[model samples]
Target chain A: MNPKNHTPLIFTLLGGLILLFIVSPLLGMFLATTPAQLFETSKDPEVVKSIWLTLWVSFAATMIFAIGAIPLSYFLARTKFRFKGIINGIVDLPIVIPHSAAGIAILGFVSRDSVLGKIGSSLGLNFVGHPAGIAIAMAFVSIPFLINAARDGFENVPVRLEKAALNLGASPIRVFFTISLPLAWKNVLSGLIMMFARGLSEFGAVIIIAYHPMITPILIFERFGAFGLKYARPVSVVFIVVCLVFFVLLRSLAKERKSHDA
Target chain B: MMLKLNNISIKLGDFQLKNIDLELERGDYYVLLGKSGVGKTVLLEIIAGLIKLDSGKIILNNIDITHEKIQKRKVGIVFQDYSVFPHLSVKQNIAYPLKGKKLTHQQIESLIHEYAELTNITHLLNRGTQKLSGGELQRVALARMLVTKPECLLLDEPLASLDVQLKGDLRNLLRKINQKGTTILHVTHDYEEAIALSNKVAVMHDGEIIQKGFTKEVFQKPANEFVANFTGIKNFFFAEFSPINIARINGKIEIHVSNHDQIKNGKIIIRGEEIIISENHIDSSATNNFKGKIIQIIPYFSNFELIVDIGIEISVVISEDSLFKFKFKENSEAWVSFKSSAIKIIP
Candidate 1:
């Protein structure tokens, strides 16, 4: 061990403390709930329904909003325009504001008295206490992760590569599809995963918007408040396990795609 | 003219290119030479339609392409860094521009192989670009651009990033490409590359084309002092001309120069290789001769640059054989001689 190596070791020790701080509580909860309890919670119809709703709603929000977000991110990366800094700040606003405040702001925009609410009412689609409202809240709170990641991905691509493609007689749109998008896909995938995971774990805004069709997070809170920690622990363990399996699966898929592209 | 830049001018925030004009004939290998940051690459980008021109018309093959889209301009450019797509195989990168041209898959494949063979990268066609050497990457970039069969090819400092042997090989390749009837505009700051690869040359300074002509003519007679210095002429002095073709340098020495347009005052340039050194005065057709002591001798490539104090320090390059034949050494007295026609007068 060299004297110069001591600083990195010290930093590693500090980092390990925070890592343990995060893992210990999750590990303790998993150990406290037995397999029998986890199986029972998984078999409960309400529990299963909430988990399904949570997964599908968040996935739907991520997929639907990504179409618009990806193009906006590309524009933000490549073009120069007035107030670009302000637009970038607005994109990151959702990540910094409190979730309850975000929910209130969304409610004010989509309430029955608002113009959009009136338009939805005309279409017989109620946003309050609806799955639509749940999706909107999840999208609002989690979209920043996707935008920032995709923007960074686009920024990392060398501008000269795109210029070379154009000089070789490819159209601008063709260059974007064949050159820019493929090079930046890895970061885009990571962003998609982050957005989906963040949306799945959302509770504050989703509860305010639509509590009838309970997501797993809201259900866990409800069970803890009513029947104490014992009842809530089983559901929490099941949810965490499911989320972990999906996260691992998505990350491996991203890695495989990256290697294949390379 | 196959291509012409008609009074092109562009402004790019704090740096501006002003009123640049150039013309190239068909099958011409033109070299644009300049120091770094003289807008050489920016000018190449404008020709390739990657940069917008604030004012000027770019006429290529008698068609105005000033407002044309890049894809429609029929021009290709190979950048200094190669910019080979990291996510694509060498073959796939070569085939990129051919994908949407309504060519059959077999046709595209055949074209890719043809260009790959031309650039001597046929073995590396299916390989990914991550681990290729710099020379291999350059070949890949060349094949990708050449496969498109562009009307004109623009190379931006193509040889600046290669080793000496690689530079020679690529210079030969560029010559072969030009001989096969592809017009090329190569941008480099290397005079050797300019002399080896281009029949015509243009020197750029401070965002303007200062001088352009046949390579031999431009090297022998530059338009100004900057061009003379840039072309590697080491002997320069301010001189006042008399009516009898005599130039007096700082009232120290007088040398005869070929008369030109009765110019009153001008700068005199002498190539180091044209000046000769001898142990004693020799009888010859040479007009100007002086006795001077050698002040310093700096070894150049296979030769020595002798700085002789003939009233004014003048640099002279001589072969090793000549150095020993004259018995030249530091602080040794010798006679220096040159013809009157050897001096270049830039007014």
Candidate 2:
């Protein structure tokens, strides 16, 4: 056999190891838990409520925060100013910090004695043990993904196109809506999906701020601590299957839109 | 004047354009010719209101619009890259500027078809912009800009990225557009494009307009050495002129020139194609003649360029037939001659 033929086999073997490492745990959990157990867990009121809360809260956080983040991303991508690099570094700071540390940081900012806590008090809103608090924690930790992705998208848009639109008698705002936003929408959509996914998987931050809201991650941690491995396994399997279905569906939708656009 | 730039000045980082003044009458096609990095695009952008001038006044159609916003300026520009919107179809790209004009749907459709047909991209209306050819993209960009009926059109090197055949086609399109009555200010580095496209030409050097006049006059009588060399005059020499119409070059060779009573010392330019070269002296009515040796022969397009050194190295271009008839070779003796009228004196 030619030595070159062996190269692909060698690469395949090496690549297969990492793929096995990622797939093995999920496969083991699914295989260990019977379908009856998964079905029973899906019917449980607590598990069903926790999963629904996790999905809706994370999605709401992504949609609400995106309003502010997208414009900030466009500003960062277009302008050159003093301390712009420092601002970009600050945006990425949450991703580098430990999740529990990010949780602690958010806790301090909204801990009833801070200025925001007082403002929330005046507005009849409490941060601790509330869905609003959980949404805030999710947004605080996952927003960098959206900002970075959208900024990259805006940077790839040619400034000359915007100028051309302006020369054709379109106002600046009109150019943004027609030219800049449409071209960058794919990246922006990808960013939103990533933020939502990251928010769904969040545990350390949500538990620290709003333990009573009982998102799926916190509930799984509680069941494992209380009833040991047997009880936690079924919930984990159900959550994984739900997440996989959502991820695959969202990605397929994105791909279908891309093909349609092309 | 349809448009005028009065003492326009702008500074961006290390580059600055200083005191640029230009005027364009109605229905005139003007070409701003310069080499790369001479601030030609910057000037075009400033005129279109895409860039703000640090100090200047812009007057269009007898109104001062020095600080008007870009959308209200009524000036359109087509960039060299032909920035057609990739997300829109060719028809949609052309229809983008017509969205807020309050026109009826039928009116907008008719206008899009009209300009698209004018630019010869009518067949590409429904197709997406990604797979279009360079010429097609250029036509789309022109259609997009022309659909709005702007007062002036600014083209930044419109023909720079095109192949030879595409460039010729687009040149004809631009000429037709100009004839239908739109003032155009075109920027290009190719002198041939200026010669073929514009009635008025200006040469820019290092952020300033060095010379501007009618196309024929500017090419024939450039203001200085830089303009002369840029406009393709191959032979230049600094000389001193006496009262007898005799100019001495480098204190070595004396050449007879046309009489200029006021020019006592100046530079003289002789076109390379005007000089006659032969193996022996021929009896002719030419006023200047010299016996020289051919030092170099370079292939220039279809003709051969010979550098003959009599007292100075003078370049002469000869046809292939002459090259063979004289059997010109390196280190061969030849006679070069030209009339007095062929020498242009610039002081």
TM-score, structure 2 vs. true: 0.86
How far off is model 1, as Cα RMSD?
4.0
Q: What TM-scores result for chain A when each predicted structure is judged separately against the true chain A?
A: 0.95, 0.96
Best by lDDT: 2
**In model 2, which runs have C-alpha deviations exceeding 4 angstroms?**
A1-20, A107-127, B235-256, B259-267, B271-338
Give candidate 1's fnat, 2 decimals: 0.92
* Clashes within 3 Å, all models in order: 0, 0
Model 2 chain B weakest 10-residue run by lDDT: B297-306
lDDT against the true structure, per candidate, is 0.91, 0.92
lDDT of 2 by residue, B1-347 (tens): 99999999999998989899999999999999999899999999998888989999999999999888888899889999999999999999999999999999999999999999899999999999999998999999999999989899999999998887889889999999999998899999988788899999999999999999899899888988899988767789998887559989999999999866668898999988899998889889898999999999987435788999989999998998889887999999999999999999888
lDDT, model 2, position B102:
100
Query: Which residue runs does candidate 1 get wrong by more than 4 Å?
Result: A1-20, A107-130, A259-262, B239-266, B272-283, B287-337
C-alpha lDDT of residue B220 in model 1: 89
Q: For every candidate, give the share of true A-B contacts it also has.
A: 0.92, 0.89
Residue A76 of model 2, lDDT score: 96
